[model samples]
Target: MELLERLFMGSPALWGGGVAHSVLILALVVALGIMLGKIRVAGVSLGVTGILFVGIAFGWYGMNVDGHLLHFLKEFGLILFVYSIGLQVGPGFFSSFRKGGVTLNKVAVLAVLLGVGTTVALYCLTGLPMTTLVGVMSGAVTNTPGLGAAQQAFSDLHAGAEAPDIATGYAVAYPLGVVGAILTLAALRYLLRVDTQREEREAGSGTDALKDLTTRRISVEVCNPAIEGMSIAQLRELALREFVISRICRAGGEPELAGADTKLHGGDRVLVVAAPRDIEALVALMGREAADTPLMRDRKMISRRILITKSELNGKQLADLKVRSTCGVTITRINRAGIDLVAAGSLQLQIGDRVTVVGPELSVAHAERLFGNSLRRLDHPNLIPIFIGIALGVVLGSISFWIPGVPQPVKLGLAGGPLVVAILIGRYGPHYKLVTYTTMSANLMLREVGIALFLAGVGLGAGEDFIPTLLAGGYVWIAYGAAITVVPLLLAGLWGRLRYKLNYYTLIGVLSGASTNPPALAYCSEQTQTDAPSVGYATVYPLSMFLRVLAAQLLILMFG
Candidate 1:
């Protein structure tokens, strides 16, 4: 340790090395970040590797010094990253909240509590010091973000103002964080084997509700035509008391959402949800030339269902089986590669294929009885709105960088400014595309590399003085890391069961931020039915992302 330390301290690299050692460390980390971004990932790899490289490189090639500047960058970068996350999550987050954010909150709170409690308890009992405690806490939460907060807390309490020896301490405890996270995930999946779709499955569909409840609908025609000349807001407000408009279809166009701001025209078909019998009564009042809202479209409604080619059902051509005759429904079209099938009797049904069916509303119910949860309708036209929202988010985030009053050299969040802006853009942007959901994957490796390098820088700069308590009290770190995993795993299991019996593997992903897995969710989603694994995944995943960034700093601060 002494020899290497001396050699790294600009002890001349046999040639003209001198001050170049420090520069080389920085370059290496930067190079690693570049390589990870360009070679490893196509996108979203920037923040992960870039941040990691910068973080770790500090420990390896840095000199122990007060890095006020670098500290500011780190702090600001993290905040920007967090703020962007908050913005992106804001829109749907509220929706999720209305549905059941309470359960999510409880689990998150428990996670942080487990981190803190484990550390404090272990510190008192094992005398493992605070640095390791921070690392353990970070590992348990799978929240790197909390690490910074915890570290700050520890430094304030024990080491006056000068931070602990972050080099050796961070290096040692980092492994613990990685290992601890891995173990907790493994244990949860092993014990619980959860799935969230069961309850939702029991909740009957809106179609059934439509049939059961007597619906009242009103229709109005306008010739004004702005987009047609009907004001969506006015029409909606006009009908607010009696009905909620469901959809509006123009001649030869996709149906527009009811509340869309298009003007009404003479032929525009407006569909409203209300009492089934009151249609004639409302129409009677507005008569003469105009009619009350009571017009049903004659076009056949499309049924949305997922059809997979299970080996048990292979080699059967559509014409041969007469699925319509046998199942009381007809296939509207098949969506194999793209384009829905309007006429596909001759097309053979292959394994792993999908089909869309349409038939009588009763036939749909009958089909379910025959096919089980195997078929459904592709009905939510609101998907377009999601994509629109995402685009807007990205624009907003990108423009923020160019905002007039914003600081020029500011680090937006994770990877300076631009990347943070991008994260927010995607996360917050209104129109969300499922394909673009993973758009950030390209920079994932870059972000990791940056963080590693930055850590190395910190380690190199802090040198060895960061470790006074560590030399004084050695066993504290082991206790801290050990307790982090134990407490969090217990809490996750308890919380998972209490909340919704969330699928075990997905819950692990939530707790640990292991989004890319060994086909856990996909396989499970296929096996059990319903995309319920994703609910558990998405519920806690956002928080986990922020936590992952902060956890790194906390480990360094507490254990260093």
Candidate 2:
């Protein structure tokens, strides 16, 4: 029993070691939480949120952890999480505001307003403390940033008495917030009698404009007499589609690399790289398809996906880079934000863009170095922009704007300030010579680590008092939070479906975005077996995150 307690609880001797036992406990909670999170019930999982539950259990068992250490880890984890998200979605954030973006954002904003209204109503009906309601509001929306922002606001207002209540309410409400969003999706499907197949078809067709570029390479014989004498540039203009003529082979000569000004001759074969649908038009304009000849299948030539990781290469035009002239490699296509774009001369390269370069193997290898294709480099976190962003966020969070008749000035707080700054940096970092890209593995690691630390901190802080509060009418906060989670989502989803005629998949995405619930988004994507939910989710996520944080802080300012 003594050994078991020492192993599980960590004795004072363990605590007095160079590394405190608290650190060990925190590590255990995080590792166990991650493993437990992978266990799904009916296709639903808590994901990284399991860390909170683990921490709660440990805290409830009287685990003594360092409070300052927990606080630092929590806030730092939150910064890393939000900053990574901002970078991941930054490039597309502004573009998502265009076209149907206004409508999508409006609907998303309305949904957030509905949640705030629901919170207010619950407050009036239950007479719950404002701090608890604010926490519930954050949890109900499944937005950890909002919760962090609200806590920051509480701290700013010197309301230390209610701080623990915020964590307690949030921890209690968060699980239902995730489940409630999924349930809202299910309820809407049943209530609206949506046809899954029909919705999928409509969503696919209606959102065709949102489709990523699909590229294909084909060899076409230039038998068309009219275009035979035309330059490669002229043929490209005539085709009226985006494609590149990478190489040309004459009737009895070697397959020579082709440039824009290279002239096409009748019976000559050309290698064309273009969008799948556009390939047909080019084929018809060029001539019949041909099998790969010996020259066309040159053994020395190769293709490789090279990541653009160097800060020096970012924001430079493809023509300016002169890889073909210097390294003998041609960039056929560029993959950015899950879309394939033709490597036009004028197209600028951004950090994280993967360019498919085709050339001699040695030349491609050289090009890889020029493009900074070091996996180790990607693994090393770029600390410059991260620390800069956090410093700026803290500064921004301190600035307050006074409004007439308001008791307190409105500030962006730690969460909002850093999030907004990260998004802007992510979008325009390349333009300003800032490298904001992180490898996918690194980004996910940072995000998971951050959320785990944050959740663990919150759980440890709330656990000691959680049981007593729950026994003393704290359970009502859970019911109130559930209502806050479901009512707004269902109302907005149904209204969007019936009135605006939104596709079911899209509506689900909007609900997920408005709630800022990644778990719900994951479920929606899995359930639909399509990426349609992602478009809607990405479209509203930035605005939804901003609004959620603002609303949480506002709720506290109004009712605290």
Candidate 3:
């Protein structure tokens, strides 16, 4: 009863005494903040960021946590959050620059540079401490890692002396930063008088140009005498295009499953799977599209989706797997991270890939066994690679580089190092025999817990000065933050539209991604009924996140 009374009464010493009290306070903050975040006002909610404000509230009411514990939780949480993000974006990070992504990323980089320039200008104009302004910039851009990076830089410079409440400036600026991005997007739509439907239509069916491997099955009847005696492999070489011959039929016989060695004879019918753009050329080369081909009507041959879960197959090429030669099944397509890829012989297999195979039922079952289609095996997390990667990240973060004129050496710090390492591991891990596949739920769980713990620490640490700072001209930080948020978005939006004539949905998505604001992305998805926004967001997110974190630390190191 006495312990319950102490817990309820909120005794400052009791609350700050040990790990149990600190954990309890953190738990309550996260729980209550999550509850508060669920209450939407006009379709916009704080989401997980509500924890920051709730932590402030707890701090304002004199809730205390042990200092050492708070610091450890905050830093560890930040590492987890950033490392998870790196893994998520690493696979597509370099590929994001292909085709149309190049243009989208150009605009996104412009937005990032413009935001940095605006913050620098504000610092010079307002005479605000760079520490505070950097915090404001991080919040205004809705980048949490940037805030963490900035704070870490400051601590390194000051040697753990009384540090300014960086999170206070972030807390002040973050809410409107979200709303401001949404407003900027909406305002651009109205000002430009964009036709969303027409823009989407003109954007080439809203298909990702990089992964345009559409599963178009064109049944063609052979008529070209030039290719009468050629193998399917020779035909592929002649066509200079990647395609799968799923089924083939003789003039008077039932359809049979096709392999690389399948021969093309005059009047033979075959079903070819390739991109839409290549269908016409393939049809011309073969003969013509046969509407009544027995290939489509074949019941003996079937297509089955096999999930790749074998660790040994992480980097094996399809040619090495020899699905067709051994299992008598042809792989038609490989789906990775929601994008369909052409299943060429040179294509390397990865864990978690879903490959579509066309063959007889027995052949497909054989192929499935070869690929290890065990969900239980895939569900098991590879913790060794993760911990090893994290350890490497810490080592990388500790190594500092001396600049030509700077007084201090520059480091990637806790946030940037793990992020960069995680991306590399995620992208090239398979080649090195490291399987970095984590279920979406597992990744999300790690990310949420990490961010929540980090935010709770920041809020509690800054709570003492939050109200005081706000009352004393800190409200102007909102105006500064708004300027920081809205101006760069508008400028980038204009440049992307006028210079490149970018599709409206893609432009807004680039803007949202440049700001690193997911709430704005949700708004973009809601406003545009196409995946153009999502594609643009994904293309820019990794680079934008890297740039934002690096910029924050540089600003503190150079100017703070």
Candidate 4:
């Protein structure tokens, strides 16, 4: 304490140590974020390293932050990051809701509801307040928005009502949520033996594939025999015209911008982000052999949201918007107040309406300029249908509410309501497109950001109170966390078997425990030794993610 005081007590850093701590913590957080973004085992959001930093800081500093500032950081950062993801993934996500795809949708719906059902069942037994119980379950599903809806419901139930110790409960279990999600994935991997047999099986099928297909950036050397005498700047400008300079590698040299003024050496290599075609041009322009490094290709399309507000090209209609003409962009769909609006000829512009657009990278960038603004923003509209479905489901579940039940309503999550609905949709929705391409992106945006914000609220709200309460209860959270992971997993394993013909990959996807849908399809490919499951898996995941978010809210409400 004395040493600390001497170094920073009067160091002009803290308004009670605010400035210094903020800088340090923010930097620390950045490092941790980088690590998480860079590393994943199997298909897990294993952000344990980040969690540890937060946990250690929380333990030492009691997780202090100005409430308003913390809220702003958490909410805005989450929305920004997730909004981009939504825009990128929206169109594909929405297509999941269509006809001939209902079966996959059914599987996804069932898995999520099962998670919710387990939470409520456990909540009833413990007599825990509904909010915390619901929050934990929703977070487990990676759907924090549900917690938000639950909070709203709780407050609505009793004006100015202090929610039950949900924050505390979430704090105790979130780390476990991360771990469980990873374990679920690991279990899925182990159960299906994806790691051990993928290469061998593929080889047998005469399509040898690399397990580490995901991209990585690396430095390489390239020599231009013809351009050795040319100035570096000229080479740089030439390269820039065709390819993005990803990075540069020089002989005992410092890396700098590839400019028209820099001199080039025979052995100099300029790293670049470019397509194979661009790379060919770059080699030809350099007049020498160019080293090619590993390049990652995205199998899925990217998306973004264009908010149609007053600044959105001044009240243009869809066709009048000239969106495609302006940017080669396609209007996948539109959203208003959490409802999906199909792309139409006359859907006039309105402030705060989110238009989900899909196209190549350049096109998306152009659309954002003309439409993205300060007052409004784009988001995945997945929440709308799920929210509507859940609201309807819960109300319906409770319409014949019997007092002898789990608190208020019939427990549909435990049963097969969600899965059944998802499958029905996936199997039959070819014409329906419950989650269209645009809608998929919108859905991902909503679910990702909504859940993150809710979690931020929970972490901030519960962190301090959680530990103290846990000790008083003799630290029962450990057991509860264990139960949360185990029960749902077993259910998924069996359900996948009985419902989906018990294919190994489907089983693994069911068990992987995280919300990533692509893996299930991948897993199916691994097990059945075919690509057909990929289609089925893709069809269901977006729909599943949407339902998980929407249902989470109502489930939280029920538990609270």
Candidate 5:
């Protein structure tokens, strides 16, 4: 028993500063925290945030590691976490601002401003240190990236001195931050006497104009004289919208695959894949809906979903490929990151897209070769681009910009630099012949590991002061944090509902996204049981994340 105690708890080598000891502690913290996070109470779990608390407990119990190693792990982990997030959201970041998304983003912006304003006000009124307030604000919003950016900015300005209280403040306020958004949603529901079912039904009634543009497919018969003899390419131009001509059948002939060069004749039926909203124009221009078309069930023509694994084909437009003219096949739809887009001429192909190609079996086999459908290529992650992008990000982050009236030049810092670089790489890497495609599971693994390491380091660093500060009037931060979380959400939620007439699901999604709270988003998803909340969440999440990270840094630089 004495030997076991010394070996497990009192060994000099185990407690002393070393790389292996630090790694072992980090591994234990992450593993235990993940296991703890999986235990749900009342359908709510702490998720990965549990790592922070577990690390804190271990630290409080007197475990220690090399400070330099801990700092390095923390910063590197933050970089990985933000970079992976940027990659995930970059593809649709710009495109998310169409039509109704503009309003949703506006609401999100307002909430962010409100949160910053509240933090500033608390700093002034409560006489609390700006560092503490900034941490509390980040925790109130449940934005770990913001907390990271604030820490980076503080360190940059303060000559590498660690702010142990920052993470403590974040840890103290984080629990309510999760619950407050959900409670605000519930309060608003009761205060306004909302009818979720009716709002859901109304949302289903086609209030959004962009709904049909992405996820609908239909068949139309060709009868209009103007387009009777026009090629499919010309017809697409006249319609002024994106649609794919998958197959065409004449009155007396068997159905065959249609392509850009396929000419239309009167009394011919064609299978069109397009946005549901654009269907009306096509139907009016072409003819009427051809229900139960023989072409849909035609046995002679084959339809196949081909995975794109060719690096050279990345960012090439569908028209540029000329699959129709070369392989006698039409790509009706291209699925990227789980969203299906109509295969239009101008649509740029990504490395990981799954395209639906319709043609003869031989033609599809030929097209498959053209697309490089080798699954083996996708198994190997393109790590060169990731390292190159990170290098560029470090360079970019080190560059400083002078703002008018500021005492010091502002830098994007470690967190902001990597995030911005990753977003750009994810969005435009293909244009420059860079392969940015990562499997979903691979990206998730990178993100989880990064965040786990970062949080563990933070917890260990802050644990010593955490309990002391809480006993010394730090409990008041809960009120401050609650105010920060609930007030902006209430105002923004009301504005979205009253001004924009947003549905309940979408409004709650906006509130959750503005806060950057995944638990609240999950709660909204569970309650709605529809895609409306997800749509709003995805539309506003990218902008909100960027703004929160920037806002936290600005608060530290200007006030801290």
Candidate 6:
């Protein structure tokens, strides 16, 4: 019994209380939580959030660890998680906001307002303390930053007596907040009788530009006399689409790699690499269908995935770079993040974009040099921008703005500041000579590690008193918290779907974003088997998070 206790709790007599003990407890909690989280019931899983419950359990068992270390890990983990998310969505964030983003954000704001209204109603009905109600509000949304902001506001207002209630209410309500959002998503799916495959097909059909990016190789014979003497560049201009002429073979001549300036003849057979949808257009403009010949099999021609690591190339359009005219290479496609983009002349290059360039071996090599395709450089983390972003976020979080009729000023807080800053850096950093690109593996690693640390810390900190609080009158707040969590989500989510005709996947994402629940977003993504939910989540996240924090404080000030 003593040995088991010492192993789980660490003995002061043997391995004195320090970082090692803290690390040991954290590792155990995270490992167990991850394994436990994978246990699915009705096709739903808690994911990494299982770590928090495990931490709470350990803390409930009277396990002691370093307090300061736990605090540091918790905050640092949150910073890492939000910052990584910011970087991941940063490139598309602005563009996303421009397209149907305004309406989605408005829906998200309505959801936030609905949630705040629910919390206020719960407070009035239950006669709960304002601090406890605010905590429940934060937990209902699964937003730690909101809770922190509320606590900060409480402290600023000298309502320290209600502070303990905040944490207790938060702990009791948090688990269900995570579960409730997922449940709301599930309920909507069933209620709406949503067909997942049909939704995917519908969404897919709507994105024509993305669908048109599929690379296809087609051969055409130059039967048109007008196009016979035209250069490849002139033909490309006439076609009015982004396709590449890779090789040309004239009567009684061997196939040779084609360049933008290469001239065509009446009998020439040309191999064009372009989207399948654009093939008919090109064929109509250029010539008739020709026999399939292995034109691309030229020994001197090569195709390589060139990574854009050079800052100078970042944010510059392909037309500006003129790789086709300058290096005689054709960029068939560009892979950004995980999305494949057809390499159009107007397509702007971002750092870390992998462009598939095809041309003569010499030309391809020159394009590679221009792009700085350095595998070693990609492995090194760009620490300067990361730290600078975090520093700026902290400063931004610390500043407060006074509001009319409010007792305390509202601040962006840690999560909001870093998130907002990272989004800007991800979108505009390239313009300012800052490389905000990170490899997928690195970004995922940082995000996972950060969330894990954060969950562990929260669980450990709240665990010690979790059970006691729950058993002693804190238990009722769970029901109150659940009400706060589900009411707003269901109301707003259903409204968006029924009125706005939002796609089920996108609606789920909007609910998750409005709630600021990562677990819900993860579940929605898994259920839909698409990243579409992520788009909705990312688009509304910054604004939702800010509103949540502000609303939490407003709740405290109004009712306290």
Over the stretch 316-427, how does candidate 3's per-residue lDDT look in tens digits?
8888887777998888888765546678899777788899998888989999999988889967888887888889999998899987776788988899999999999988
Alpha carbon lDDT of each predicted model: 0.43, 0.80, 0.85, 0.47, 0.85, 0.78
The residue-by-residue lDDT of candidate 2 on 402-453, one tens digit each, is 7666688978877777888888888888888888888888888888888888
Candidate 3 Cα misplacement greater than 4 A, ranges: 1-5, 8-16, 161-163, 203-232, 238-257, 263-304, 360-362, 403-407
Positional deviation of residue 342's Cα in model 6 after best superposition, in angstroms: 7.4
- The lDDT of model 1 is 0.43
Tell me how far the alpha carbon of residue 416 in candidate 1 is from the true structure, in angstroms, after superposition.
15
- The residue pairs in collision within model 3 are none
TM-score, predicted candidate 1 vs. hidden true structure: 0.47
Top candidate by TM-score: 5
lDDT of 4 by residue, 213-245 (tens): 111122335565666767644565556532333
lDDT tens readout by residue for model 5, 375-429: 8898888898888888888888889998777677788888999889998998898
Candidate 6 backbone collisions, by pair: none
After superposition, the stretches of candidate 6 with alpha carbons farther than 4 Å from their true spots are: 1-20, 144-171, 193-198, 207-306, 315-317, 329-348, 355-369, 373-375, 516-531, 549-560
* Backbone clashes (count) for model 4: 68
Off by over 4 Å in 4: 1-45, 48-56, 59-63, 144-167, 175-461, 510-537
**What C-alpha root-mean-square deviation, in Å, does candidate 2 show against the real structure?**
5.2
Scored by Cα lDDT, where does model 3 land?
0.85
Better of 1 and 6 by lDDT: 6
